[model samples]
Every structure is written in structure tokens, then in C-alpha cells.
Target chain A: MKLLVVRHAIAADPVEGQRDSARPLTSAGKRKFEGVVRGLKRLDVKLDLLLHSPLLRAVETADLMNALVEGETRVTSLLARAPSKALIEALDEPSVALVGHEPYVSELVAWLVTGERQLARGFPFKKGGVAWLEGEPVPGQMTLASMLTPAQLRAIGRKK
Target chain B: MRPAHRELEPASDAVEVDCSAVRIALQEHVARARDAEDSRAVHGLRVACARLDVFLRLGRRRALRDDLRWLRRSASNLRDLDVLLESSAAGELDAQTVSSLSTERTAARAAFLEVLASERCEALLDALANVPSVSAQRARAPLERLAERVRRRGEQLLDAPAEFERHHALRRALRRLRYAREWLGMDCTAIRALQDSLGALNDALVRETWISRVERPASSALASATSDSSSLVQSLSAGALHAWRATRREILELPA
Candidate 1:
């Protein structure tokens, strides 16, 4: 099985006293992440399903990908935090995309590749970055196949 | 082993020891408050002041405490009014009373803006930019001290949740603790949850107090207002008490 772990794109600056969960992606953010998605398509990336955090920013990010990937989208609190063992165990899709926030996304990548969740070992994803891994659906079983930043994705996306 | 909510909380970015970032944040909050049209801006301003107050305290900027206090106080009445108006039963109050409260709110907001525009306010924001830079390592000693006080106060508050004053004291203590944690780039959702529950309880209590002061004898409208506010007070107290019992130790004992 293969997994594409994506960090959310740049969201709007949080208005003072606004709910963090309600801050959506800015128009520019949407445009930028769309390019990233196009780039992923160019890279032959595909997904059967996309899981995202319930937070507004991540949800919007997932929506952009779903528009093109035509994948089923699901919300999980697990993506908002550390990935649970159950999350990996329950996965049925051959190609699933997990969209979420920082550190946690990186932590998941670290745990999957190294069988340990270490900040120092984690692959920090830039905003809109995606790390592609392939392996059995268990901790330390996955291998990092590819990683792409927003700029690289956008650049690749711009190609014919 | 990091807890789930710990991961959800925004881990502070690499905290630069500089005070300018904080000062700029506070100034932006103040600017928003100056033209605010909603409760959010008022709340944002209040939280900003409280956060900066803790920063000043941590850096031993004792002389500026009064300015911070004054800035916070200027908004207190308006904030209270905003909370009251936002309450569900605020509509139940007699039209005259509601009108009177609205007028008071308007005046209070004017006063608050006037204070914000004052020379003193400018000085306070200016002073913020110049607070002696505190090394992250150096902030630990005082933060640890505050943590002890918060734990002690949490114990007292849990013992006497009904004591009106203890609620205020513990709320302040928890807020200070949370801000200190933010400065050091740590967040405990438990602390944030506790503070929010306490604030809800406090808002309910303040609504009760506001009505009692303005209540008119034989006024059916006032009577309805009191009933709704009393209900809120009871429900919120139960929620706050329950939250305190559950998270008190976890949040209070969190090391600085």
C-alpha cells in the first residue's frame, strides 16, 4: 500500500479571537495548493481516499485535492493529532492521502519509517509539502519513496 | 509520550528571546480594539493585555504593571457589557433596562477607546518594546515559581468552587500559567479548557450580578432576565466545577 501525507496549505491569518478551527485557506492559499495538486498529478500521484483534520484549513486543503483526485474524503481527529495505530490498521485503500497540521504530520512520517516517533528524526513538511511512502500498513514498515515541497510541486505542476 | 491534545495544540515556534514580537502583537491587538465592532476584538484585546502583563512580570518590569492594569481595567466594563449582551436572556430584560445598558456600553466603549488613544497607552505599548530581553533559560526560575502558586491555588479553588473570589483568583493564576507556557512554546489544552470553563462560569456570575444591581421591583422583564441568568450561573458552575475536578491536577502540576 502507498500513502501520501500532505500538510495543509497556507491558511488565512487568524483573526484575533477567531476560532482556530474556523480559519479557512486564503484565496492565494487555495490557488497555490491547487498548483501543488496539479504537480502531484504530473508526478503520477493518485489516491483512493483522503483523510484530513476537521480544522478548516486542512479541510479546505483536502477539498482541493479531492476535486481532482475524485477520492472519498473522510475527517478524523487522528489526523489532527498523532496518528493512531488503529488508523493504519483500519486503512483499506491502496493509495490514501492524510492531510493535517505540522509536527504531527512529520511525527507520523518519522514513526512510520523509523518505528519511533522522534521530533529530531521527523521529516518536517513545508506548508503544502507531501511525503510519499510505500510499505505494509504498520509502524516502521513504510519506506519514504518521495518528498516534495510546495515550490517544487508548483514548479513540476507548471510543466506541460 | 506526548498526549493527543498536546499534539493538537499549536506548538510555539522557535521562541526568539526578543520582546519586539510580543509588543507588535499587542499593538496590533490594541489597534483592532480601537476600531472593534464585536465582542471578539474586545476579548482579543483583553487576552493580549493579560499576556503582555505576564511577559512584563516575567521580565521583572514591575514599574509597568500599573499601566497594564490600567489598560485592562479600561476595557473591563465594556467587556462585561459585551458578555451580558451576548447572553441568551439579554433580550428578556426590560426594553428600558436594555436601552440603559446599551447606552452604558456605548459610553464605556468610548472611554475604552479614549484610553487606548491616550499618551499613557502609547507609553505602555512603547515600554513593551523595550522590556529587558529574557533568555528562555532565565525565564524558567520565575515560571516555575508561578507554577507552584497555580497548583496551590487550584487546590484551594477546587475546595471552594462556590467562593466567588477564589474563582477569579484561580482564573487569573491559570491564565498567567498558560501565557508563561506560551512564552516558552508549550501549550496544555487542559489549561486552556479549564480557563474557558472558568470564564463561562464567571460570565454567568457576572450576568447575575449585573441584573441584581439593575433589577426593578415588580418588573416581569427583570424577573425573566434574572431567571435565565440564574439558570446559566447554575449550569456553568456545574460545568466549571466538573472541569476543574477532572483537569485540576494535570494542568496545575504542569512544569514550567
Candidate 2:
């Protein structure tokens, strides 16, 4: 199985929203996410499942990617928090893309591949950055396949 | 109640010791009961086990071993019946659908109550009530043993090879870690983060499994059936994984 973990793009500050969950993606976030979609295409990556948090920023991110990838997209309550047992139980896919908030996305990546609570070093996932893990989904066994930032994708695009 | 035990220090120590022992025993029973297949028995056992575990760790009261053991056994017995009924309800047979299952479930619960009310069980409960209290210091060995058993079982499950098995195992480990954190009066924030990653991995597994096993095959079959008439169906069927990935974006857009 291949797991694509994406942190949601930059979002509006929670000040004007009733809750942080309601905050929408920033313009920069939208642009960055579009860049991410373009990058995935350039990389020739295909997804089987696209999952996102219920948050507006995550939903928008998933929407943009769904437009690009040919797969199923689902919004799940499990992605809403950093420590979601329900989300873990809900996994039954082979190639999945998850878009959610930080501390959670980073922490989840660390936990799945290491069975430890620390974040992976040097993996500074910016808005619209994508990290990929390939291999079996056993805890502490998945290998980091690749990670691409919007900047990297743009650079590659420029080269092509 | 009439005459107070004048030595506060001894009483305090006694309470601490008993509480520790009960807590250990309670957790042990809870783990065992979860493995049981009966829902009612499992529920009762889990509840009592949790109560005793919490009581010892949080309530700081020591109850007799006989009392704890009786609770465990009774809970286990109830759980067995519960599991049988639940499993029966979950069977693929036509009679096991939700509505039919409810009736069987109700009968199972009543039968369990009747079993509990029998003479032999009541006698066992009476014997349980007569257990003598021990010093707090006497509980160390049993507590350590129970903790070791839990740790070993948890490790084994977490180390399973299959993705589905590993997912469940990791979840169990997370739960145990959470329980341990609560018991030790520690923060659970880090453990919670680990759980989230595990969740994401599991989600990926599901999508991957569905595409490979179901959607892709079904799409291919449909494409083959229509291939003679149209080229579009063949093209549509060729990239099942890609198509599934595309649909995922829509699915993820739904309200969580």
C-alpha cells in the first residue's frame, strides 16, 4: 500500500470564524494546493482513496485534488484530530491521500512509520507539500517513498 | 464504623496497598473479558473491571481479592453469553439481520439473568463476599505479574504482520498506552498523536484494498462486457485505481 499524507494548505486565521474548524483556505493555500495537484500529475502519481478532515481548508484541498486525480474522495471525522482512533479503524484502502491539519499530519506520519511519537526530522511539510510512504502498512515498517513540496514541484515543472 | 482505627498511618498504608492490588486485578480481568465473544458478558465484565481498576487507581480503596475475583468471574460469565448472542446476530444467515437479531439478543440477555440468579452462582457470590483483606504490601507481586502479561500481549498484537491485524494491534497498544497514562497520572497528548497517524495509515489501507479487490475488478468486468460496442468503457475500465483516486476527492469533501 502507498499512503500520501498532505497537510492542509494555509487557512484563514480563526478570529472571524465561530470555530477553527470552520476556517477556510487562504488564497496562498489555494494556489499552493493547485501547485500540489500539478506536481502530482508531473510525478505521475495516482491515488485510490482521497480522505480529508471535515475542516473547510481540508475540504477545499481535497476538492482541488479530486479534480486532478481519478479516485474516490471521502471526508471523515477521523481526520479532525491528531489522535483519532476512529480514523485508524476506518482505513481499508491501498493507496490513500489524507489532507488535514498539522501536529496531526506530522505526528501521524511519525507514529505509523516509527511506532514512536516524534516527528520525522527535516520533513518540513509546508502548505500543499506532500509526503509519501510505501510498503506494507504494518506499524514501524512503512518506508518513506518520497516527499515533494510545491516549490520542488514548480522547479521540476520549470525544468520540463 | 463504631470504633475508629486510631492509627492513621497504618490505615493509610492499608488503603494504598489494597487499592493497588485491586487495580491490577481489575485491569487483568478487563483485558481477558475483551477477548471473550459474548457481548453482555463482555460488557458487564468490562464495566466491573473498569470500576475496580479505577477504584484502586483513582478511588484509592482496597477491596478483598475474593471480591475482585468474584466480580471478574461473574463479568466473564455474563460476557460469554453476550458474545454468543452477538455473534449469532452477526452471522450471514438471513435470520441474523438486525430485526431478527434484536429478538435473539433480548432472549440471550434474559437467559443470562436467569443463569446469574441460579443457586450455585449465588453461593459463589456469598463466598466471594467473605474474602479477608490483606496488607497493601502483599499486592506487589500480583500487580507486577498482571502488568507484565498486559505488556506482553500488547506487544505481540502490535507486532502482527498483516495490515489489518497490525491496525487493530496498534489501536490496542494506543488504548493500553492511554490507560497506562491515566493510571500513572501522566499527560496523554503524545499518545493521542501517535493514534492519529495510525488512523491515517489504516484509512489508506482501506481505500487500497477496495480498489484492488472490488472496484477495479468490477470496473474491468463492466468494461469487458461493453468493450465490443464502445472504446470509452475500455478506457474507463483501464485506470480503476486512477478513477478511484479521483472519486476520493469527492468523498473527502463530504461533511465529516
Candidate 3:
């Protein structure tokens, strides 16, 4: 199974800055995310399942990716959190792209790949960075394949 | 040995104090054995192995890991032979059941029982007499490690930048936020409601994308079809145009 973990694009501040979940994507964030869609297409990555966090910004991000890819996208609360045994059991995809926020992505990566309690580090994915993992679905079997920032993506696109 | 409570520590440190790798290996072996046969004994063995694995992963801090280890191994051996016998009997019965002969079914049952006796199912039972009560403490370490990883990740998401292009960061943040709530063991009513609303909005966008890309083209094709048909077709096209204008008005009036 291959898991593509993506961070959502920049978003506007929520009304009165109520909570993180209430935030919306900024205009710049949208354009940059569209660029990400282009980058994924250029890479020729075929997604089987696209799962998003049930946050407005995350949902918007998933929508953009779903538009780019040829599959169904689901907004799952399971993808909204770090690794839960329940979430792991609930997953029924061979290849999945998750659109969510940080720390949890890093944490989930660490947990699934190492079976150890440690945080993932050294991948400074900006507002539109992607981290891809490829390996067995079993715990402690996956390995990181690539981490790309939006700037890196644009650079690659320009190079092509 | 009596169980002893200890302060929480890293898995590495705990392993050094009491090796859990051995127990994990044994549990794996038992599970593999169970998978090889389909029988009551195998089911029991699988359950026992699962329990041992859970015990080693979630048990209380003070429990004796070595005692738990010994009990698991003993149980594995007993369950292995019992599973083999039951599986042999069940397989024969399944074959007999498929055939339409009462005598063959009876003979199959008798042969299965004979094989069970020869397999020394009683000897396995005798060995089980000395099995000890394995505490559930052995299972705590893995669960603790998993929980810690989730909590740290949740904290990271909470502190991460909200705007990111790849959407992975935002997704991770949302997951961690939800995981944090789970870790805190709070009620899920508010979280569920928020999740539902977000899901609905996402579905709406997906539908909109599909309509714009696919349904609109089809609709336009349908509209053009009337240009070559009867006068009634022209009237139908006019009605369709009027309906489109009305639909646009309704959409414009909708709350943003």
C-alpha cells in the first residue's frame, strides 16, 4: 500500500480566529494547491482513495486533489487524527492520499513505519508540501519515499 | 514472582529491564500456528495468543513479564495439538457432509475420533494442568508507546502552520486535533457534528465539480439536439432556457 500525505494550502483566518478547524484557504493557498495538482499529474501518481480531514481547509484541499485525480474522495474523521487502531482497522484502500494538517501526519508516519513513539522530523513541508510513503500495510513496515515542497514542485515543473 | 509497579518509562528502557521481544516473537509464532488449522483448538489458541499479545502490550506497570511469557508458551503448545486434531476431524466431516451418504458420514466421524485419540489429545490436556494465571500487564507497553506517539503527533499538529499547499499538513492537523480529543477521552458529540458539516460541504464541492465537468456538457448537447427536431422541440428548448435562468436565480439567492 502507498500513502500520500499532503498538507493543506494556506487558508484565511477564521472569523474572530475562533478555532483552527474554522479556518478557510487563502487565495494564494488555492493557486499554490492548484499547482500541486499539476505537480501530481506531472508525476503521474494514480490515487485509489482520497481521504480528507473534516475541516473546511482540509476538505477544500481534498476537493482540489479529487478534481485532479480520477477517484472518489471521502472526508473522514479517521484521517483527522493521528494513528488510531480503529482508524487503521477502518482503512480499506490499497493506495490512499490523505489531506490533513501537520504533526499528526508526521506522527502517523513515525508510528506506522517504526512502531515506536517518536515524532517525524527534518521535512520542512511549507503550506503546500507533500510526503509520500510506500511499503507494507502492516505496522512498522512502511518507509518514506519522498517529501516535496510546493516550491520544489514548481521548480520541477519549470525544469520539465 | 509477584507483580511490581514501576514508573512509566520508554519502551527501550522497559525492554532492557524485562525483555518483551521474546514474548512478541512467541505470540507471533502462536498466531501463525493457529492460522494453519481451522478448529476449535486453533480458535482457542488464536484467542490465547491474542490475549497474550494484548497483555504484553497493555498490562499494568508492576506485573511480572517473565511469568506471563512462560504461561503463553505453555498455552501455545497445548493449543497447537488440540487445534490439529479438531481441524482433522472438521475437515473429514466437511467432506462427508458434501457427499450424500449417511454411512460415509458416520464412518468419517468414527475415523476422526480414532485419529484424535491417537493424536494424544489427553496428553495435551495433562500439560495444560500446570498453566499459570498470566496477568494482563504485559500488553500495556505497546499501548503506551502507541498512545505517546499519537499524543506527540497531536501536539505537533496543534502547533503546526495552518496554511500549506500540499494539504497534508492541514489533514495531519485535523487528525491530530481529533486524536487529541480521543486521547483526552472526551465525549464526541461536538466533534461528530463538526465532522458531519465538513463532510457535507466536501460532498457539495465534489458534486459541483462533476456537474461542471460532465453534466453541463451533456446538458448542452441535449439543448443542441432540439435545433434539428420538430417545432415542439424548439418550444422545449425555450422552456429549458427559461428553467436554466430560474436555476441561476435560485443559486444566487442561496446563502454563501
Candidate 4:
């Protein structure tokens, strides 16, 4: 099983009239994240499941991701600040791609890889970054196959 | 405005496809890491380079080993500088020392870019796009070879002297072994923990060396600063030593 976790792309700053969850991905964010999907497609990553937090930006990111890979994209409240238990429960798939927020996404990666509740020091999950874990979906059963920054994805995507 | 997403076509079924992809990843990561100079990028570049090195070495392509070595060397001083600067920013080192280190980092960055542009590096990157006839049977050879090499290195580290240089070498060994285990998709938490301890020890030793080499002021403030820094380094080194010993023992006692 492979779990590909992605943080939501660059989002609009909090507006006076809008909630944080409603902030949409900025134009630049959409363009950069498209490159990420392109990179994944180039790698022949076939997602068996695609999930996203119910937040607008996460759903939008998942929708973009859905067009690149073969999978059903569905909104799930479980991915929004999901607890470790809920995160583990969501991992029951041959290959899953989860689009979510920062700190939480990085924390989830740490928990999945090291079985530690907190992220190992200095491990950052930048916006639009993606981490690939290969192993069983259970806690600590996975090994981080790869992690890529958005810049890296753009570079790879630009190659022939 | 957003551009249309690039359509992803199906990749070739060749086994080399995976290797080629990994190569692209290595190149992309190393290039991106060069500009960041952060701890995470430095670590990522090292791991990416290691993965490619293991894969290439397994394929008996020694030609690129020199290029990989150069890449690692280019990143080494910068990494250590970053570690030192992190603590220096907290007022451990004087402004003069911090400025000197930052200036050195700029030179290091330039040198790294020069190497990245070298013909050898360009050729290496170009060659990585092609993995000749990596069959299913041959695929397992690298993992087995890496595992054996890691085991041998572990034994060497256990018997090696406890000198600073030896421990540094051990740190490298642990990193290689851990990266190989990761390449093989094996659980590497224990090895990673040990590597972390070894890294901390290395950082402390680097700090001590830097302080000892750099000239300090002849004032009471300098005395107080030196005392504080020395104790911090001593404690850090000791804790790391203890962790290394404990982890090593656990490794040795594991089922063979």
C-alpha cells in the first residue's frame, strides 16, 4: 500500500468577511499544485482512493488531484484536524491520497512513519508538498518512500 | 490566472522507468535543496543522493560515484554551518563569529553551484534518465547487497575507536545504512534513532571545534559566554554518547 499525503496549495489570506476554511487557493497555488499532479502522473502513481478535508481549499485541491489519477475524490470531515485514531482508520486502502492542512499533515506523516504523535524535529510539510509512504496502512507500518517540495515537483514536471 | 493542468500520459512499462523516475527525483531534489540551505533541504538532498548512489553502485556503475561524492561534499560544510548558525542565532556565538560563518556559507553556496554546473554532474544527470535492462530478478540484488554492506559497516562501527573522527565516520555509516533500509522499504526507526544521536554528537563536536579555533574577546563577557557554550556542548556530547551506546547495544542484541 502507498499513502500519498498532500497539503493544500497556497491559499488566500484570511479575509474580514470569510472563515479560514473558505479561503480558496490563490492563482499561483493552483498553477503550482497542477505541476505537482503532473509530476505524480509522470511517476505512474495510481491512487486507489482520494480524500480531502471538508474545507474549501482542501476540497478544491482534491478536485484538481482527481483529474490526474484514477480515483474517487470525496470530502471527509475525518481529514480536517483528524486525530491519530481517525487518521489510521482512513488509511485502509491499497493507495490513498489525502489532501489536508499543514502541521496536521506533517504530524500525520510523522505518526505514520515513526508511530510518534508529534513530528520529528525539522520535518516541514510546506504548502503543496507531498509525502509518499509505502507499506501497510496501519500505524508505524509504513516507510516514507519519498517527500517532495512544490519546487521539486515543478522541476520534475518540466522534464521531458 | 491558473494554467490548464498538464495531462499525464501513461508511463512506459520498462523496469528502468522506476529507476529513471528516481533519478529525476534525485536531480530535482538536489537542485531545489541547493537554494534553500535549510536543515530539511540539506538532509533531503543527502538522502536523495544516497539512494541514487546505492542504486548506481548496485548496478556496478562506479563512474558516477565521484559525482555523488562531490555533491555530498558540497553540501557537508553548508549543513554544519546551518546547524551552528541555528544555535549561534540564540546568542551562543558572538556576532563576529556568526558573520564569519554566514560569509563562509555564501562562499560555500557559490562553490556548490559551480560543482552542480560541472560537466560531470551534467553528464551524470543525463545518464540517470536511462537504466539499462533492470529486470525483476536483478532488482533484488541491490537490496541484498546494501543490507550486507550495512551489516558489515555496523560491525565496523561497533569495533572502531571512540575518537571524534571515528564517531563521525560512524554517523555516515548509520546514515547510509538507514537510507538503504529505507530504499528496501524496511522499518528503519531504530537506525534513524541512532543516526539522530550520532548527528547530535557530530553537531556538538563541530561547535566545540569552531569555538576552539575562533579567537574570542579578552573580557568577563567572553569568559561567561565561553563557560556557557562549553557546558552546553559538553552536555550535548555526553547525552548523544549515551544515546549512541544504548542504541548500539539494542542493535547488537536484536535477533540475528
**Residue range with the least summed lDDT across 10 consecutive positions in model 2 chain B:** B1-10
Best-fitting candidate, scored by TM-score? 1
Question: In model 1, which regions exceed 4 Å deviation?
Answer: A1-160, B1-16, B35-38, B215-217, B254-256
lDDT for each residue of candidate 3 in B1-256, tens digit (9 for 90 to 100) = 1112224332223322232333344334434433443344433443443333333234231112222333334443334334323333333323322232333334444444343333122222221221222332343344445445534433443454231211232222333333323322323343344334333333333322222332222234333322323343334333423332333223222343
Looking at candidate 3 chain A, the ten consecutive residues that score lowest on lDDT are A67-76
> Residue A58's C-alpha lDDT in candidate 4?
75
lDDT for each of the candidates?
0.75, 0.51, 0.48, 0.66
True contacts kept of each: 0.00, 0.00, 0.00, 0.00
Comparing only chain B with the true structure, the TM-scores of all models are 0.84, 0.38, 0.21, 0.74
Q: lDDT order of candidates, best first?
A: 1, 4, 2, 3
Q: What residue pairs clash in candidate 4, if any at all?
A: none
Give a tens-digit lDDT track for model 1, residues B1-256: 0111223323323233445565676677788888767667777767777777677566543335556777888989999998887764645777767777788889999999898887557645644553545555567667887788787787887788778678778888888988877766675689999889889888878777776665355687677667877888778877877887888768766544
Candidate 2 stretches with Cα past 4 Å from truth are A120-122, B1-256
Query: Tens-digit lDDT track for model 1 on A1-160?
Result: 8889899999888789877776778889989998999999898877787776667677668768864455555556667667778667646788888888888888888888888887424598888999999988788888999888999999999989
Q: lDDT per residue, candidate 2, A1-160, as tens digits?
A: 8888888877878775246665767887778667767777777778777777666677667767765445556555456666454555445677778887777777777767786647654455778778888877665777888877778876665566
Off-target runs (Cα >4 Å) in candidate 4 are A1-160, B1-17, B20-22, B33-43, B132-161, B214-245, B248-256
Instruction: List model 2 lDDT by residue over B75-135, tens digit each.
Output: 5433443443344323322332334435544555555455444433333232222222334
lDDT of candidate 4 over A50-154, digit per residue (tens): 766756677567756865556444445556764468666766778899888877787788877888756544457889999988888766778998889988987
lDDT comparing candidate 3 with the true structure: 0.48
User: What is the CAPRI rating of model 4's predicted complex?
Assistant: incorrect
Kindly report the interface RMSD of candidate 3, rounded to 1 decimal: 24.7
